[model samples]
Target: MKFFLWVALVVFFSGCNNSEKENTEINGDIVYDMYKPSEMSILMNEMYDYNLKIKQEILEGKTPVNFPTNFLNIYTAELSEFKSRNETFQAYSSLFVENQKEICNTDAHSDISERYNNAINLCISCHKTECTGPIPKIKKLLIN
Candidate 1:
């Protein structure tokens, strides 16, 4: 009787593990990481790196490279749907759409400065509503 009880408990726990695995790979999508404060911070770091690369391009007298590519790839790659909410990353992404034109166009060098400032501003704005305390770093990204 005791042996049978132990077997049943093991079976129940094993089934739970299987379900958890299923949730991780939902509908062919691999949920790498969900949108949270930590993940967004990392995504923001990618944006900073992209900004540096764009600066290099400007120094060499070339067009602005695709900043969105670097930012979005890292952001999306780390996003997964939460239990109910869509994802906090959407906030950053929503603001990104407005800057897409400037971000993708090398011809927008003169415009890129404002666009860069706007991008940093939006990052702070959204993070304020979602995750505050990173405003200092975000503000530093804005052009003087």
Candidate 2:
């Protein structure tokens, strides 16, 4: 009876381990170093959504009165494998943020649309190099 109990426990644990591994696979291939973004990813998604909405307003020929500001200062959870990716993102993001600042600080409406488009371009460039999976979604943010 004790021998049977030991065997059952071993079987259960082994099954659990295998399931965990299987859950991480895609198309029957094991993925390596998958970065699971933390809850902070939600905030990041929200930021992107906000930008998309603004872009839509621009496409309709309406100038947005308020622009996003200081979003990069907001902290988000980082993946270890994404250190280089994050750096690249930050570099491009700085340009986006600066453009936003300039738009907000000045009364000049002449180049506001152009600057907004430029910001989206930077976003696309970074995503193209680091993580191309979201290219489709990012492209949707383009104003023109």
The number of the candidate with the highest TM-score is 2
Put down candidate 1 lDDT per residue, 27-59, tens digits, no spaces. 885443222333534666667677656655545
Error in Å for residue 37 of model 2:
3.8
Candidate 2: RMSD to truth: 11.1
lDDT of 2: 0.57
For model 1, the superposed segments whose C-alpha errors exceed 4 Å read 1-40, 52-63, 68-70, 73-91, 97-101, 107-110
Per-residue error for 119 in candidate 1, Å, reads 1.1
Query: Against the hidden reference, what TM-scores do the models get?
Result: 0.51, 0.58
Residue 119's lDDT in candidate 1: 64
Clash counts for all predictions: 0, 0
lDDT string, candidate 2, 24-64, tens digits: 45798544333344343544576688777777776777667
Alpha-carbon lDDT, every model: 0.53, 0.57
Off by over 4 Å in 2: 1-36, 74-77, 80-87, 103-106
